[model samples]
Target: MNAGKLACSLLLSLLTAQLPACSFNMNVESMLSPPRLTAEQEQIYQKLQNSVGSQQVRLKY
Candidate 1:
């Protein structure tokens, strides 16, 4: 019984640690009006935004 409790506690701790890492807030408007990016940087930024957007959606669900 003690071992089972210990395993459950450890699992919970690991999950909570990961939760903080998943916690993210982005302000895309800050980027929108910023100085222009080089073509390569713009493409990369767009890809990042798309990826983050998807992640945000998943988190909301």
Candidate 2:
């Protein structure tokens, strides 16, 4: 009975020790926003947006 109890305690401690390895810590600054686009890129983006428009066209019966 004592051996069984010791084995259970050992297993529990090992499982707890391994828990931290599965956890993650996220740093806020590491996930900062992306840099802004240049003026020429912005113009191209606007043109693409205008071509797409605000409608969802469908072609099914």
Candidate 3:
């Protein structure tokens, strides 16, 4: 590979090694702020919010 591409590849590899994939987690509130919505979007967002009050259990084997 060319020098520039090689340097980028090495930098990315080092970054990933130091910070494994699971170490990165997004802050949901900022990612999805309340926005102006149409009727359908509002309805769906309400339904999603309602579901948050309920709990769903999962078994990871």
Candidate 4:
């Protein structure tokens, strides 16, 4: 490759490496919106939620 092409390619690679990568995250819209579950669903969710805690066991596949 020519010197100009090499320089351009290197500059492009450096610029791409320096740029921050985009990521998906839970935003306000998702956080604020309610799933609007029925009473029975809510009760089931509450029961299941109460059963779990911060500490969890990792089962081997």
The TM-score of predicted model 3 comes to: 0.31
lDDT of 2 at 39: 100
Task: List, residue by residue over 1-61, the lDDT tens digit for candidate 3.
Answer: 6999999999999998987556545788667754577899778767776787666533233
Question: Alpha-carbon error at 43 in model 2, in Å?
Answer: 0.1
Clashing pairs in 2: none
Give the best candidate by lDDT: 2
lDDT, each prediction: 0.73, 0.77, 0.72, 0.72
- Model 2 quality (TM-score): 0.38
> What is the Å distance of residue 30 in model 2 from its true position?
8.9
Residue 2 of model 3 has an lDDT of 100
What is the alpha-carbon RMSD of candidate 2 to the true structure?
Answer: 9.4
Q: Write the per-residue lDDT of candidate 4 for residues 1-61, one digit (tens) a residue.
A: 6999999999999999878677657587866754577899778767666687554533232
Residue pairs in clash, model 3: none
State the lDDT of candidate 2 residue by residue for 1-61, as single tens digits. 9999999999999999988886555888877766666899778767777788996433232
The positional error of residue 41 in candidate 3, measured at the CA in angstroms, is 48
Q: Which ten residues in a row have the lowest lDDT in candidate 4?
A: 52-61
lDDT of 1 by residue, 1-61 (tens): 9999999999999998887666455788754663667899778777877888855422111
- What TM-scores do the predictions have? 0.35, 0.38, 0.31, 0.38
Pull out the clashing pairs in model 1: none
